[model samples]
Target chain A: MSERSLIASASQTIGPFYAFALTTNTALGVMAQSGAIGERIELVVHVVDGESQSVADAMVELWQADASGKYQHPEDMQARNPDPAFSGFGRLGTNAEGEAAFTTVKPGRVAGPDGGLQAPHINVIVFARGVLLHLYTRIYFAGDPANKLDSVLAQVPEERRSTLLAYPDRKRRELWRFEIRLCGEGETVFFDW
Target chain B: MHSYKRTLPGTQPNRRHDAYRSTLLRNPRQPLIQIPQTLSELTGPLCGDNPIGESDNDLTCHFAEEPLGQRIHLSGRVLDEDGRPVRNTLVEIWQANAAGRYNHPVDQHPAPLDPNFIGSGRAMTDDEGEYRFVTIRPGSYPWGNHYNAWRPAHIHFSLFGPSLLTRLITQMYFPGDPLFDFDPIMQSIPDEDARRRLISRFDLETTVPERALGFKWDIVLRGSGATPFEDAGK
Candidate 1:
């Protein structure tokens, strides 16, 4: 095939009216229900800008493997079985306070690209008005033993890695808290891939 | 070595770019990080067996009535960099009303909003990667981005490609919009040809007789390009 001359369209900001266009009942971020087999957990996220201000109009999406380490995607060619009850995906727009919460089970370890076992993590994508391109990151359980050995986490600078860890909430035992700062100090570790 | 444009410069909000809002908080510089694609990035969220229904593609009937203004039939295809159709992908659109006012709460434009138009719709691409929407042409609206700056008539589009990394959000503009040259947001892109890609062409073939006119636009995801690699040195 010949080299294509048409350049791909440049991206624009999600803008303020994205909620009016994209919101749906299912986008409220409930990946697994009561019948799903796993320890149910809630992920609470706050989207912030460089000045530590809340980004109320941002959209957050979560993708992860099922509790049994199986992804409900066609690309997962492994012989592992998936949890029928788990859809393994969720999306939600930030509220007036720049916060979004997801109800799902903690995912199990998945295979890393380097033939190693990656630590359990939830992949996150952020879209908002000020951001021209969507930001990509991961949420790792703060106390997970495998974090130190995870290939992806190992590549991050030691000091900045903590930004990717989601700590257990002090008041709520079932909830994990993650703060994604789009820029400035304590910015979350964003990925390019 | 293949050199692809990563990020365009002269687009920072603080760069006195009049078309977009100026703010101190925008990311001034972005480092191009090289990381291998993971399963999570390689896989995208599924839109279910039938992401769109017959009526979902029509923005004119959302509020139980036809929206006021000139109706149009906007059609497009979602293709990979290889030019193959990307079927079943979800396509979403939103825009201002015919009077340059959005139905959103934050919009304070003096123009009256059309009660019949909520200004949003969704559709899944067909086997040929084609999708269509029926909606009225949006009007130019004033924004506080700069002095006397009015956004050109345009529609916002969001698409979920085959992989999460390929997800894209862009705006589609009408051909021959007078504000195209003055709009800082449109001029933010450095390449002239790339900027032109954002404008849809008038398509008589897809136009409905005695109904809405047709406009054609196509979106190409990143996979259509050769594998991206980091160049040595700054």
Candidate 2:
């Protein structure tokens, strides 16, 4: 790589009172729109702290491919049909109970860096008042058969792999439950830049 | 060719800084695991159709009357690490009104909120990677972070560069703000020079005679470095 002169500027917190300015009259947190083809699922994410206390200020942003295993981004120069209804972008802040739920359809398999197929997954980034720099992670379905074949998931430790899995709820036919522990025991795995 | 540079350690604020009390419980203790940048990192959502409005960049004229405050023009370019222009990116900004009061239910600060000012704006960068906003200077506000914690006058900035790795959320400060030394959020950056990057410079060239003062702060985001070809020689 060529040597660069400017270094990227440091990041600052979003602060507590960013709700009014940041999320005013925009698509708050709708991931998959109507007419999008895929298994419609409601994903609920809970955020907790080292003391097991709920963190109410955290905001989660997720990006994934459509049901046809294709991203609608320009960088995904693949030969596949684009789902006009699916935006593949989901954003929502946690409530007082530290829950951020999304009405999104299940993402399909995507390509890895080396051109191999990857497991169905969602790329997640978390931002909060306390999170100085945003944290990166991924969410994978619990019963996905392709999990074993994911190269990225293989890099994570076996014990810590559970931190990335979102288990299906027994009562809700299309509900999946995932919790992110910021620190201490059972802390969710965070990826570095 | 689309790979990014590794972050220099200590340049960023610690997630567990003790001064910011909110970080005590919210910060993750474990070290972040390093991984290869996949397609997810290489690409980001293209906020297509330009959701920004014709006057979205100007926060002063949103209502029937002009807001009460010192008018200013905030302008800058979105550049990559190599100072290359990052074109067609989305830039979103939010701030307190001129009275240091946010138009939000959560802000309990005792200040008047201007009915004409919502304190929120969004704009898309041009081919030159530049963005301009016309708004009043936001006032300093007190916070419950600590005893008599008054935040410096600043505007919150959110940007989505071409790549997901380039996503950023930061605050842009006015030049020579008195709160720079006292604010934990400003002091959180370990490097003094890096912290100065957050402050905008007063530019005389962009200043209009009687209309608005001008300030410029070019933001730099993570960029793709030129990939060296080694496999060909081997």
Best by lDDT: 2
Computed on C-alphas against the true complex, the DockQ of each candidate is 0.42, 0.76
Per-residue lDDT of model 1, residues A1-193, tens digit only: 3355344557776777777777666544888877877778989899888788888888888888998778877767779677877778788889888899899999988878788888999988887776766678899999899998998988888988899899998888789999998777887878874
* Candidate 1 lDDT, B36-77, residue by residue in tens: 666766766766453466898898886767889999999989
Q: Residue A25, candidate 1: how far off, in angstroms? A: 2.0
Q: Which candidate is the best by TM-score?
A: 2
> Model 1: what TM-score?
0.90
Please provide TM-scores computed only on chain A for all of the candidate models, following their numbering: 0.93, 0.95
TM-score of each: 0.90, 0.95
**Candidate 1, residue B87: lDDT:** 90
Q: Rate the local accuracy (lDDT) of all candidates.
A: 0.79, 0.86
Cα displacement (angstroms), candidate 1, residue B58, comes to 0.9
Task: Give lDDT: candidate 2, residue A16.
Answer: 78
